[model samples]
Every structure is written in C-alpha cells, then in structure tokens.
Target: MNDSLHTVSLIKIALYSAFAFVLSVITVVFITPFFPESAHDFLRFLAEVGIVLAVSLFIVRHLNKKDVSLRSIVGDTSVSKKMLLFSSSLTIGKLILYFLFAGLVLRFFITQPEFAADAQSVMEDTSPPEFNRWLIISTVVLAPVIEEFIFRGIILNKWAEKSSNTRALIISSLLFGLLHIGSFIIPQFIGGLLYGIVYIKTKKLIYPILMHVLNNLIPVGIMLIPAPESTEAFSVSQLIAELTPVLNVVSLVFIIALPVFLFIVYRYSRNLNDEVAPFKFNTRKAI
Candidate 1:
C-alpha cells in the first residue's frame, strides 16, 4: 500500500477503536440501568463484544480492501506439533508467573482497607446466574480473541510500521495496561504488561491469546472447583492467611520450572518464525 493509503487506514482503525470503546463505556454506564441488573450486565457484555468485532471488521475491510475473518487473523499455517508444544509451554510459564504476581505479590501489597473497599464498591451489584455465565464466556473466550486482535494485531502492528519492534511493544503494552483502568486495574495492568512481553517474544497474536485465555480461565476454573462453604464473607487477609502455606509450595515449584518453560517457548517461537517467513515474504511480494 502507498504511504497515503496506509496513513488513512491507520487513522480509520484508530477512530473505529475509539468509537467502540466509547460506545461500550456508555452502554455499561447508561443502558445497563434500564433492565434487570443481571440481564443488563449480560447484554452489556454482549454489546461490548459485538461493537468491538463489528468496528474492527468494518475498519479492516474498508482499509485493507479485504474481508477480516478469524482465519485471516490466525493465519493460514497449520498448527504444527512444535507450535503446539511451544504454545503450551509458554502458556504454563505465564500462568505460574501470573499466579505468583496476582496471588502473592499484588494480593499482599494491595490488601489495604481502602483498596478492599474500592474493589467491593465496583462489584456492588448481584449479577444473576445467567449473567455470570455470559460474563464467563465473554471473559474467557470473546474477550481474549477480540482484545488480542485490536491491541496486538492492529495497534502493535501499526506502531511497528513507524518504530522499532521494542518501542512498539512497550507502547502497545502501556496502552493495553491503561485500557484496564477501574476496579481490578492493578492486576489487569500487570496482566497486560505480561501479555505484551509474550507478544514481543513470540511476535504472534496467538501467544497473547493463549496467555489471556489461561489468565481468565484460571479464575473461572477455580470457581468451578468445589470448596467448603462458609456463611460469612472472607476478608482479604483471612483468605491470604488460609492459603499461604499452599501458595508457598506452589510458588516454589513454579519458580523452579519457569526457566525451562521459557526456553521451550523461545525454541517454539523460533520455529514458528521460520514457518511464517516464507508466507510473509510472498504476501509482501504480492502486495
């Protein structure tokens, strides 16, 4: 594409993303109140997903002069055994680090009474069972795909055109972190930063998608596991105190295995790069 055309495409993508974000915020703030809390929450989640997908598809199609499909984003290459191994290794590594940070570090430092109050205020509403199901789906599936497409696929790609890969990664990562503002902001920011690193290392949206899916799935998976019931709400300190012994053991094991997992990811990513190079070269030539 010509410089003028590329510039125009970049602008359009930015505008569309901005519009989608604004629309999502508005829907959450305003439209949610008109319906029952649970139904409203569910609808809002769906609306956000729909808006993002629609906007992204529309902008990419108009700018690139081609249809934007999942296949396009995921690429046409077969998932080789090596790629699977790498993805799995990287995913496991990420989960371990995430748990260390979220379950241990953040949980320890950010456990002030004010922080707990703020967190409670944000989660004030009692979402219905159906809403909870939709929330889970949105978080675990739709969110990971759509967000990776926008942040890594579009934003990072665009920035990489005009800057070094490292610079692009940092900028995109910061934007990703900033985008997570509100309740749960700290953990979200840390998650974004970690995903950014994964994106930089793998140079594929899939790495971050896997990381994201695992991040969301871990909590959802925990919720699925049966636990002893208690009538009273558990304080942050109480929960931490209860889990400290188990968390310590898990952390030690993860720390020991992390380096090996990182090495596997590095090798896997290299293989993926080798496989993708020829396709990228051909695509460039065709363009």
Candidate 2:
C-alpha cells in the first residue's frame, strides 16, 4: 500500500477507537444506571466489549477493502510457534512478578496498608448474588478478550504504523496504564506494561489476551478462597492486616521466580522473526 493510503487507514482506526472509548464511557456513566446494580454491571461490561470489538472490526474491514491486513500491520511471520510459546511464558512470568509486586506493595509501601483497599471496597460494594460466576465471566473471559482487542489490536496497530516499535509499545502501554486510573492504578499499570511488552514481542493479540486473563483470574481466584471473618466492619487497614502474612510469603516466592521465567521467554522470542515472516506474507496476500 502507498503511504497516503496507509495514512488514511490509520486515521480511520484512530477515529474508531476514540469513538468506542467515548461510547463506553458514556454507557458506564449514564446508560448503565437504569437497571439493577448487578444487571447494570453485566450489561455495561458487555457494552464496553461490544464497542471495542465493533470498532476493531470496522478498522479491519476498512483495511481489507484497501488490501491490507494483520500481515501488513505485523509484517512476515517467522517462528510463530516459538513466538506463541514465548508469549505464553512471558505472560505467566509477568503474572508472577505483578502478583508479587502487588503483595509487597501492600505489605510495605502502601501508606494505609490496605494494598488493594479500593478494589476490595468496590468488589464488596458490588457483591452480587452469583458473584463467583459473574466474576469469572467478567475477569477471565470478558475483560481479557475485549481489552486485548482494543488496546493491542486497534490502538497498538495504529501506533506501530505511525512510529517505531519502541515508540508504539511505550505509548500503547502508557495508554493502557493510564486507562486504569483507579485505586489499583499502580498494579494495573505494571500489568499493562507487561502486556504491552508481550504484544510488541509477539505481534500477535493472543499473548496479551492470555496475560490479561491470568492477571484478572488470579485475583478473583484469591477472592474466592475462604477467609476468616472479623467482627468489625471491613476497613482497608484491617483487610491488609488480615492478608499481610500470607501475601508476604507469596510475594517473595513469585518475585524470585519471575526473572528466570522472563529470561526464558526472551530467549525464545529471539527466534520468532524468521518463523513469522511467511505467515505474515500469506495473511497480507489474502487481505
């Protein structure tokens, strides 16, 4: 494709992503309030997913019409299997690292000692009847798939087109981090960085999806595990105190293991360029 055409395609993608983001925000803030709390939450989640997917699909279609595709965005596919393996490994490694980070931060650095107090408060406040089932669907399935499609698929794709790989990765990752501007901001930002690195290394959406799914799943799984009851009303400090001892040991183990895992992933991904070249070409041709 010509530079002019590529520029046009990129503009379309940016417009679509921006539109989806705005729509999602509006849905969450206003449209979601009419239904029952649980129903509203579920619907809002679905709406957000829909917006991203719809926008991404539109961009893909636009690209296809101009005879471009993922291949054009990613270029040649060599070592895809290796890339996949490395990506999966990196996802696991990062999860371990982040979990440990979250634990340690809660254990020591967080002034109030309620490491994820805000998240905990939201979860408690939004407790639904089938909380476990809903939580699994939202975290493991919905969040991972949809968020990856939006951040890695549309946003990163556009960034890669307009800038160097390093720039694209950093900008997209920063956007990912900033989007999670809530009480759990630090941990989410760390998670975003990990996901962005995997996306850039693999040039495939699946890696980030797996990483995101695991990131959400681990926390929800921990929440599912039974905990001792305290008579006092839940306070952030109290919650941190309850989990501090267990978190410290878990964090230490994960922190130790993460670097080893990351090294393996890095080594594996080094061979990916050659493997992905053919696949990328074929995909471009098909488009």
Candidate whose lDDT is highest: 2
Question: Compared with the true structure, what per-residue lDDT tens digits does model 1 show for residues 1-287?
Answer: 32222243656666877888788787677877777865876786778677768776776677466332333333433445665565555565666666664555544545466766655564454443232777788889988887777776656655655665556556767777777766355556545655655555544567678778887788788777765555687665665576667667766766676677657545544533223222133244445
User: What lDDT would each prediction earn against the true structure?
Assistant: 0.61, 0.62
What's the CA error at residue 14 for candidate 2, in Å?
4.6
True-vs-predicted CA distance for residue 266, candidate 1, Å: 6.3
Model 2: CA > 4 A from native: 1-5, 8-38, 70-86, 109-138, 154-158, 161-163, 183-203, 228-255, 258-287
What TM-score would candidate 1 get against the native?
0.65
Give residue 148's lDDT in candidate 2 (0 to 100).
68
In lDDT terms, how accurate is model 1? 0.61
Kindly report which residue stretches of model 1 are placed more than 4 angstroms away from their true locations once superposed.
1-12, 24-34, 65-74, 102-131, 182-207, 230-251, 254-282, 285-287
- Indicate the worst ten consecutive residues by lDDT in candidate 2: 272-281
